[model samples]
Target: MIPVIKKRIYLGLLAATMLLFAGALGYIWLTFFQQDGGWLRYITIVAVVAVLACLIVIGLGFAGIVLSLVSEKNITFLNKPMNFTFSLLYPVVMWLGKVFKITQDKIQRSFVEVNNQLVKAKQGKLTPDRLLILLPHCLQERECPNRITTNTENCTRCGRCPVGDLLPLSERYGVHLRIATGGTLAREAVKKLRPRAIVAVACERDLTSGILDCIPLPVLGVTNDRPHGPCFNTYVDPDAVEKAILFFIQGGEGNVFHVSAN
Candidate 1:
């Protein structure tokens, strides 16, 4: 199995563990209140039942996500619910990772991987004009005087940064590529362009956040490599970006293009 799929299975297990842990605590609470009979007991029962129902829904959502990962296509009806459940569970999963002494980046990267798979499973044909390649501003050389945040076309193709390569590729593909300095600007670009699909590149944290934030919007995330450290002169494979572009532009039909696990 692919590493990302394994991580997703592990993530699903973690969510199940969280539910079991909650159930255990609830059981202990009920045991402590066994001797009491009053409105408090009724409230406790209601709360426990409610929690149980939520757990059931979340479990189904996890199953949906897992099934989508293994299947060729996403279950159209479950997509929104799965994404919503993921959004609800993300923070809790991060906390669980901490309890288990797992690095946040690892979990975030796993989340991105699973998200990418889900998005890819839902892939459909899109005109190049309707596609967007959203990139983080950190991909730019820090020392460069030119700022391409507001307008990527301002880039002079100096070859010092990935943007130099990406710009020409975007032009060749006739897709809109925008470099965003932060989340606010990124959202603005999304809002203004209203692309049907997006190919986003960023670190684990931002990519995870962006995936959650752009729920119901297909986003194929390619994690950037942070060589110098967090957010400084990060690098992404331009070829990966192209593959993502092809995945969408070609409608991802019949193995014409494959979304890589990297």
Candidate 2:
């Protein structure tokens, strides 16, 4: 699910650019009027107005973020806009952090943490059928020959992979579960399934991107565990997955399923 916020962000950026251009023109007009020493007051007023307009655009973005944090009912509408604001602001924030020599990883982690809180705030509105559990193909054992991507029922419950437990959990909860290889397949699955909410498992990068892509759709991201290395033989805590699932299913109240990794 590519973020629906892309077009919105593009439009916002376009508007900001126009405002900046107007501000520059106003500044130039003000400078020329100062040299001519006539009608300089009008040019100065125009420049101040243009600068204030630019500041208002920036202020609206920050306001969106703050409202997203404080207002739970508005989460459905505000989340995507807030994500767009973050996308626009993140690079600048990172650059300033770098200039100060602050750690980028910490900054990213903080962003993810805040994103998660916003997601959780909206989860209370979801039901079981509207929620989906999205898994990564890397969660499967490398040596396994089964292709669970097309049909999870193909899994033999071999106990070697978390899919063994996940299969039953999905069936028990009556939730749609799909294993996707990459963003394209994941987007396709999301499109076909048409779920209102999603619980996604991946690395921090994938989780962050997927969350952004699936804006306005509440998504709780759980980072997978990589014991051997990245991509190959990656794992996730089944309890964590189950908890996330139940958070939407049971309105954030359910017993944690004890998962056994045999």
Highest lDDT model number = 1
lDDT tens per residue, model 2, 1-262:
3222422333333344445555666667566655755577676667767766545555565556555555533445444446656665556565655765757655555556656656655535465778889999999999999989988988999889888877787777788899999999999989998998899998877886787788767788888888898898898888788888877876754344554433
Which candidate leads the pack in TM-score? Answer: 1
User: What TM-score would you give candidate 2 relative to the actual structure?
Assistant: 0.71
Which digits, one per residue and each the tens of the lDDT, describe model 1 over residues 1-262?
6435546644764575657657765785667558578987777777777777677667777778877877756887776568767888777787777787888888887888788787878857999999999999999999988878866768888889888988876877899999998999999989999999899999989988888888878899999999999889999998899888888988883545543321
Q: lDDT value for candidate 2? A: 0.70
Least lDDT summed over 10 consecutive residues: which range in candidate 1?
Answer: 253-262
Structural similarity to truth (TM-score) of each candidate: 0.89, 0.71
- Estimate the lDDT of model 1: 0.81
